[model samples]
Target chain A: MDNQDEIRKIQLVNQLDQLETISRFLDELAEAWDLSIPFVMKLNLVLEEAFTNIVNYGYQDNETHEIVLVFEKQNERLLVSLIDDAMPYDPTIAPDPDINLSAEERKIGGLGIFFIRKMMDKVSYQRMGSNNVLKMEKVINP
Target chain B: MMNLNFTEVNNYKVVQIEGRIDTITAPDFESGIMNLMSDGVTKMIFDCTKLDYVSSSGLRVFLMAQKNISTNKGMLKVCCLQPSIKEIFDISGFSQIFTIEDSIEYASGS
Candidate 1:
């Protein structure tokens, strides 16, 4: 049998508590795909940043919105995409925090997006119809 | 699952955090820092030996505590971070902004 690329997916609502579910999902993927704990955590941090951004500021209504995460192992590359129906947001273009700034000069709010960009090897965002898709990738063992 | 244990060493209020600090638990972490600041406990040491993971949410709390402590002329130092967590601190430029020590004793100057 040809070794086909493996794919796993989890659906979460735009809520902070779902981060635990996301962590479990990533942990399960690590166990199945033989990913390192540190690598799993890197992905975890990236997803948490993106997920928190959506939950806190993506939507303006009280209604619940669904966010789907698709994880795929494409040979040596690991890829994950976040799909949400919230307002159009592009995390990749957000200005990075001034890392050189002292504590007094730093701002608390922008570091979430900055962590996402710094942790992932490649990050891209696209507004597909009504959904916001943020794609992230990392090549393993390079 | 996460837990924060507080201990006092000299003038430093050492906060030892265990488990991952993610989106769900960040609020608790924030309140813990806030409570300490309000109590006027100046010198602080964040013992992170058991803290394996931290997202930006958690980092924000760290920054907040630092800002609050510094403004009031108090010291905040983080010690015993796991390498992975330390890398997060490093990449986020947290290493530069916080006084990081290799041991809690060093952090508390005890």
Candidate 2:
């Protein structure tokens, strides 16, 4: 909570159609901060994967919910925070598939989190105050 | 968020893709191509002129299509990919495996 750190926040409605807008917003933020190309691509993928899951799976019974995304930059690193009041489902608990499985034998789902874990430098999740909070960060420079 | 359109150009199956090709829509993409393949149409060209995004999943579908077409001795060409999607392809070394062209005419050989 330092005054020197920069923060950007956007509130998203829980719908599959809003995924693209969220990604575009993130891209604009990245450009404004002069984020590198590779870093931007990686961050864009993570945001799309996470938000899609939220829009598809979260609030299955409810028609609407609010998803808040916050972007902060510090020390050449970008930290993205996603807050949603959907059901309590932690991506980390999902089982990781055996990479050795052949294409035909492998299960279809659960690869999104695995890809996110590989692409992003750090990812963490928590449930606080009836909200699911996911925080991910990437270092654009050494 | 994939903006997709299909057209027949110069006797070639052309799929014009736009916007992002991420996890959610990658499966739809794979299915779309598979539907065409199942109909016994093999020679295809992907016109990516307006495509602005692609994830590894999207790349995976391309790899799968390459394999399918190779087994059948059919040609699968990609053309007019924008910088963002092309960057992903280049970084992942897909430029070597697929026949990518600057335009659909080049890919169609006409």
Candidate 3:
């Protein structure tokens, strides 16, 4: 767990259609690792938010961009790292949505990052060599 | 990969959603709900029993539908969410905003 030997990685192009492709990859990972239903669901949720953000707002041009995701299991926790060569954006520091507001008054811009924060136990962001690296971890204990 | 089936039950429009609602399918989902609202169908219940997954985009659609229904003086309820989807709703605090029921009968009645 301390080494990178067990890390699983998937690379994708920055496109909305790639969400399904990445989701299938996660499903395979879940089955291979015997991940619980809730765990897999949460991971998928986080992936969708992070990946969609990169695809929708990360690029200024229409050209395709690369997005890399790495998964690692350490002790009782699962760590996921999403790396993209898009704009330098840190979702960890994004504003939390005001969930206390009524449905009519609620705004939608920040809910994705907010959900990512709420579901994951730990979330860290770093700009590494022109890549926006977002790392998230969740406890996977039964 | 999402399918939305709309049915009328006791004068309430029930939208049964299947498959995953993510960034790609959220626009269609939003427009479908908006179509219902434009058609003057306000009393709605979203049946999420067969919905495998939903991301933040889907939540935004739900919020928009709720707001539209409220402005029209209509009602909106959701029923039969899977455990995982329910957890997302709970985390987003949607459980407090929308009336959620265990069954469509309860949702329609309420």
Candidate 4:
């Protein structure tokens, strides 16, 4: 990675609209770097789900919060690290949606996270002090 | 961003949605379809050939449109789904409820 290409960061308000903006930013970045479409789509979906989850459910009082997203292209993959100041919650601990249930029978919610897990090559969640950090990476090839 | 073009083919109101139909765009989609319904254009086919992606919110709008059309004694058809978008639909079991076709011609034929 070049010194200038090590990392790029953006600060977003915890809101639904941020999902599209972030996805577009990542999409353009991926295309500029010649990343695969599948990889870009997977990363966009994961970020969309994660950020939306935070904006919709993470804050109990609906107060303003900031989410920092960092994009970096590593040796063989792209790494996106999201840091947010919100309540402590681990998405990985959430129960997997029962795929057996029909759409009508299944309860609403949780589907986004499930899709993210299926799409991303790697996902990690951690809470450090006041920041909830989510790091997801995907290999450029296969 | 999605470019939505509304037109008529064989007297059936067809909505062509290009680009990703995800959360941010689904609300606009729901309103657009509902506008068609208000105009007495219920028998519809959503031409999704250019729709490269969709999320659960997009599915919700589809369900809303389906219910509205079904109750109005009309029909809604879906055609030309890209594979990435189709996988989401298939995984969500939407394929069972939606009248999916390989092409607009095939869907309009019925």
Candidate 5:
């Protein structure tokens, strides 16, 4: 394969409103890179879930933090790494919601991370210094 | 972005939701459903034909509606889901949780 890749990053404040910014960025990238809409929407879903978790429960204080999203497209693989300076939390450790349970038995929690695992081909988490990095990757289906 | 329209068909309030229902739009969508419930309106059918995308938050609202309808002795049916959204429902086990119909007529019929 060729050794060419495109990398881009977007910095967002620790606010729920930034969800629209993420969607817009992905929309523009998909249009410019000629990526399929469905493929990008999956990426968008995971990104939204990851971002919501960070912005909602990451920090303990009222201080504003910056969340960063790094995207790289190489060949047939698309990878996104979310970096945040919030408390040390690893999303990959969360248990999946039991899909076998009844509606009343199931809790509303855990589905976001579940989606990240289900939609992505690879999901890995790392604690680097003060930042928690969650990297998700998916192979483009041609 | 989301657009919601409500109509009555065969004793069921059919709510047609269009566009993506992500974190940004979920609260609004939830409130819209809440309004219907507060008005003592139950036995509803959710038409998701144009709902191209749904995130975890959106799924939560769906679950809430279902639970509320059950508690009120009413029924909540979801119909006309796009394949992509259906895959989400399947993965989340929502397909078994709610009554899913291929058409709004079928959803309202029962």
Candidate 6:
């Protein structure tokens, strides 16, 4: 965590429309770091899934809320931390969807979390005060 | 943001999708494809050559469409998936569920 290692953070409103903005911000960060297209795409997918879950189910009220994302590059791994005050939820504990099941019998609710786990090297969740804190790490193979 | 374009080729409905299909655009993607079911479209090919990305939400939409088409005794084929997008499908086990081909012609033939 060098002071000059380009730590980027963004606060997005809890709305589906903000997905595009989040993607742009991440793309900029990835570009600045010279990350490969495949790596950036995978990171983008992981972030989208997590953010979508928070926007769709995190808050119970009709008002707007802020979801924060922090990104950093550490040695051979990329680290991303998400902080939201919407609810108390731990996606890491969710059961992995049975990928072996046929398409007709497969369930859709859990694939988002399951994909995140499969794409990232490590995923950790914590409750800090009133916010749900999630951290994910992915090793840069290239 | 996502864009879907459809064309008819030899009695097969070919759909070319572009841009990202995340949670924000998946519902529209689902309904757009499902609407074709009403037209009695039995043979379909999805060309993903221009598709930039697909998340879990997108996968759900594809799965739903495949199931619906199967129920109607139709065949759904996907072709020209970019490497990364194909990787997502492979990781999700969707590669086993759908007929994925290398090109539009091959998909149409199948």
- In candidate 1, what are the lDDT values of residues A1-142, reduced to their tens digit? 2445388889999888898899888888888888998899888888988998899999999999999999888888998999999999999889888888999988877888988888888999999999999999998652
Each candidate structure's TM-score, on Cα atoms with residue i matched to residue i, is 0.95, 0.71, 0.94, 0.84, 0.95, 0.95
Give one digit per residue, the lDDT tens place, for model 5 in B1-110: 99999999999999999998999899999999999999999789999999989999999999999988998999999999988789899999999998999998788885
Pick out the ten consecutive residues of candidate 6 chain B with the lowest summed lDDT.
Answer: B101-110
Q: Which has the greatest lDDT?
A: 5
- For model 5, residues A3-121, the per-residue Cα lDDT tens digits are 34388889999999899999999988897667887888888889989999988899999998989999888878888899999999888889988988887787889999999999999
How high is the lDDT of residue B48 in model 1? 96
Report the first chain's TM-score for all candidates. 0.94, 0.89, 0.93, 0.89, 0.93, 0.94
The digit string of per-residue lDDT tens for model 1 on B1-110 reads 77999999987888999998887888899998889888888889999999989987788889889888889998999999999998998988889999999998788887
Query: Where's the lowest-lDDT run of ten residues in candidate 3 chain A?
Result: A1-10
Q: Per-prediction TM-score of chain B?
A: 0.97, 0.94, 0.97, 0.94, 0.98, 0.96
Provide the lDDT at A2 for model 2. 67
lDDT of 3: 0.88
lDDT of 4 by residue, A6-27 (tens): 6778889988988877877877
Clash statistics: count for each candidate: 0, 0, 0, 0, 0, 0
Model 5 lDDT, residue A102, Cα: 80
User: Taking the true A–B contacts (Cα pairs closer than 8 Å), what share appears in each candidate?
Assistant: 0.89, 0.06, 0.86, 0.14, 0.75, 0.81
C-alpha root-mean-square deviation, each candidate? 1.6, 4.7, 1.9, 2.7, 1.8, 1.6
Which residue pairs collide, candidate 5? none
- Tell how far residue B42 is off in model 1, in angstroms: 0.3
* Global lDDT of each candidate: 0.89, 0.78, 0.88, 0.79, 0.91, 0.88
DockQ of 1: 0.83
- TM-score for the second chain in candidate 6? 0.96
Docking class of 3: high
